[model samples]
Target chain A: MSAFDIYIKSINDVLEELKNSGRRINVFNVPSSCSELPRTIPVNIGGNANPGIILRQDTYVELGNPEAGSSAIMISTNETGLINDGRITLIGPDIPESADKSLPFGQVILIGGASLDDKEHETLQQPGFVGDKIEGYMIRSLPQNIWSRISKDGAAKGFNFECLGKALIYLYKSENPKIESMEIIFITSAKDDVKLLDNISEQVRKISKEITKENWKIKGYDIDCELDCSSCGDKSVCDDIRDVLKSRKKKGLVK
Target chain B: MINIYSQLMSAANKSLFGLTLGPQNESDGPFIMGNGDFFIEIPVAFGCSFSDLTLTGAMGTGLPNAAELIDKGTEVGVESRLCNAIKVATYYLEAGLLKTPDMIITTNSCCDAMDTLGNLLNGYKPWAHIPRFNMHAPHSYDDASYEYMGKQLRQAVKFMEDVTGRKMDMDRLREVCIESNKQCQLLLEFQELKKAKPCPAEPDLAREGAEFKNWSKDRISPQVTEWLEILVKETEKQVKEKKGIEGVDEKIRFLWQDLAGSWASGTVLARLQKELGAVCVMDYVSFGTWTPVDLSSEEAMFTSFGKRFLLEDPMNRQALHTTDLFCNDILQIVKDFSCDAVILPAHIAHRDTNSRIKVVRDMCHEKGIPCLVLGIDIWDKRYMTPDVAFDRMKTFFEISGLL
Candidate 1:
């Protein structure tokens, strides 16, 4: 057993308890094996992607919509055992089932490979690794979070969690050769489930952040500020300018 | 990060460019961006010189009525395709916003935009009678090239003094040159300070330091050098304390080549900082690693001045010179500062830089550095909105895996 076995087991245990509690759960096995997964970069992006914006009028369904509340859980483990090679589990209504509804989204991707390590974690989880390859999916945020839009055209072409699961499976496995097994869970059932996923994600987000830090550290970087520095960053004027700023700040110039 | 940095910026803001900006008729300084050791000899460099194009560009474009000012420039048969900053400057002279100078020294350190603009400034009805000396710069660099430009420097001194009736003081000029060398050394030290891990300086600091460089042109006043000294001391303290910009995380360090012309509404760095931990570590204006002047003799001083004019000056060295200098400048900064990416703000008017950007991108690719070529006018926001720039940059960071 590798380091991620416990994590995979915990995820399974949670899902099993949810399933036993009468939550609508559907399990699917990808039609193709990992080796035969068709690889594709989204035709819409064409390598040089502008911010993919699926407008409100053109939208089929929004997942993890910032307004609807969103949480994402991503973890990769070297323990290839206890891994369902091509399984996608969906909770609540499917993508096609919801015509124009916003869902409190929970997306969890679990990867297991015998050779997987920390360094490859970033590449394996790059937005392109998921968003770029999935034909109908457009992610609107950075990694570790997903505020995504599925197009009406994509839904017309029979896009749903089953196909999304298969698309992402093909996307990830085809792009990364070391990956031996992968599993994904999409929960659009309730805000409570999304929050639960956020709670469960603490351990994985910490690990992903460390991977990011390690990679940047090798290139001689230290992430500097964690606060709202952009507000103070631009207003860094001095002398008479600073004096004016001080006066304005006292008079409620800026929050 | 430093306490005195604002003071330095304040001093820089008051350089030769601003001397005539507001309703100031008593000011004597006339220095602009160009002129090295010979810079002060131009009669205008008697006190202040302004550097950073970003600060000047920001001030020009952000003027609440800048678009109207630009429209006014176009009204006078000036082409709108010309750099917006140059157009604004043209409008300033035409509208009497800038007072007619006693004498104006026009050297084309930038490109062809200056050629037409120079003609306008030189022939403007009110200032046409004044002693207007068009300083000549050579295309190549060599010993004879230095001597060739050096001779012209002497002519400019004679021209300015002959008109102003002030004798050229050799000893005082020498003293100013020596002091100028000290300020340059301190600036070089400040450049080294920026390369620290976590980048002790923020992106705007480089933008601010670009203007501070011009403040050093006030050779007679030791105050500019003192400001530089405070900059170095404060920056050194920041480094020793492992300090960085108050609110920057610096996850990504990028070199902003050709950020010299203007700030793109000052949005790129802040957005990049807030969205990603990307901080602009260095830019073309802030990157000055020049060979100091010999300062031994007055003649050599002119020669060194000529060398620096073509070889060492901020925009002139890279923008006016060969494609090799341009590529080498980008690659050198990338390595020296350990930058992961390069943002070439392919401002529309930079025909010189825009033509060579392909070569630059290819070279960056060879070195495993991602280069983003953004096609926008650095001086004008209407050409490409700040939001569009943000989208492109964010996408670049994502696709390049910097995110």
Candidate 2:
């Protein structure tokens, strides 16, 4: 009946649809205490005492901006346990500390579920949908990148990474029943620390894309080809043969 | 023991071949290069060699490894979301495989990828020594936009001259413009021949395929003019002889949008032709015109060049303007070429054009023209293998009752 409930329901429907379309779905369950966890956190941009979602104008800059280090990484792992369900870790300095400074940013989301499979690779990578679903969170660039903004109103209501991480866990748990545990990690402290995680994150992104491309291949789409047609000399002969085969098919003789 | 004259000629031929392939080294002199989507009219007119970095990377002509270059670019911090073509160009430059241009010229005609790549190139070590000229195309096509583009054209010429130490010879520019206009006329005539019932140009798939493969190399040379003339003559003979592609029954005619996956091994066009009796008689890359320039005077030539680049280059036009053009062109081309359907190759790199697919699809639907959007990456065949593309086309043709 509530807006938040409706949003949760819509996300469930999307996950259900993906499942019905032969994509494996994964959902993890967390302790009921996770939902009741306090939303107040000190992730505000200027160390402000605002609640809910804090608009951190100084916390992070656009990746491509000269001020920003232009480093980004996204990591997802299935190595999880039941106790770690809905657990989020912030390894680096909070937003207030890095305000007005360009620093490396990293995000890691770990999920554990009973039914998770290679087919559900994209399903787990659906955290990008959170930026759109959250009423006041405005992600400036692609969610996979660190360029994001929060509405002043949301920040005043005490918005922080804890709130976002909790919301993600709630959504995933509510949407799919298969997930048994989920954890979100944020690293924005120092460039050296972020760099190590970023290297892994980059590898994860590559593997995820390869998985998606493989899925397309299974569904009958060739994401790429292996032939070097640019240098081929017998192209005309091949074209002639193909033409003849096509003609026979058109005449209903080859089919 | 070769004669000195013979040795000199051989060396010259080798150098010319390297230039045709792409800028081989910094010593190749002040070359002007940019995205292939924009017109290189001014650069060509300035007597400077023009290289389309996107096409060079796509064809893997001079690069040590196109895929590796793309990876290097991503590792160096270019956004992975950027199109592979732009990434490949950036990688090639960063890896020292591509010779840095004396000056980089580009227009905000297509997408943000160009801007990102241009910025990265500007910061790259090789390009830091040179200047990068960025031209902003107006959103609306009018007299004002034409004038603005004309000013940019003149500025670009000056920049080229400044970098190359060459004077802008009005007489030489006019001569090149005349030849370019002649080439455009020949191209238009060739397009007209596609309206024939059997389609005169359908049989020359091999030649067209080769041209698409070596698109970058062939563009600036007189060889393009010769090829166009040969195509015109061949099409004329086909019209006289009433010949189409040898085995094709020509049961269906389709208009291919932008670049098709013709670079792929089996090719989307070849698949459609063979399995469903569909002939892609016209495609955006080959059929689109770069409106003829007037060679009467210096001002007239520059104005014509500006108008062509601003109003005629499809990638440079506004989104709404481009959609309208697509609708109008598809409608007329369908009737003119007797096309039964439209095949819009949704090239992943061309995000700007991909956004207009729904509009084109709806227009075709209203007109009772069946349109199929094939998800393909034109430059990279790995994005859509020939078998996969063929299966999709076969299904679409079967549903449309063209098979």
lDDT of 2: 0.56
- Model 1 stretches astray by more than 4 angstroms: A1-255, B1-11, B14-20, B23-38, B41-59, B213-220
lDDT of each: 0.65, 0.56
User: What CA root-mean-square deviation does each model show from the true structure?
Assistant: 25.5, 24.0
Tens digits of per-residue lDDT, candidate 2, B1-403, equal: 5533233334333443454454443233467767554445455556556676665555552244645656666686777677776777777677787655667776665567776766665567656767777777766555566777777878877777777777887776777666666666555556645656686555333234224323333344566566566666766777667777666777888777765432642466777776667787776645444445756567756677677776555455423143444455666566545678888888786766676666667667866999999878766666777678878877888899987
Q: Which stretches of model 2 miss by more than 4 angstroms? A: A1-255, B1-29, B35-41, B61-73, B203-223, B261-266, B317-320
Against the true structure, candidate 1 reaches a TM-score of 0.57
Highest TM-score against the true fold, candidate? 1
Flag clash pairs in model 1.
Answer: A224-B249, A225-B248, A225-B249
Q: In candidate 1, how many clashes are counted?
A: 3
What are the candidates' individual DockQ scores?
A: 0.01, 0.01
DockQ of 1: 0.01
Candidate 2, A28-52: lDDT as tens digits? 3334343453233323221112212
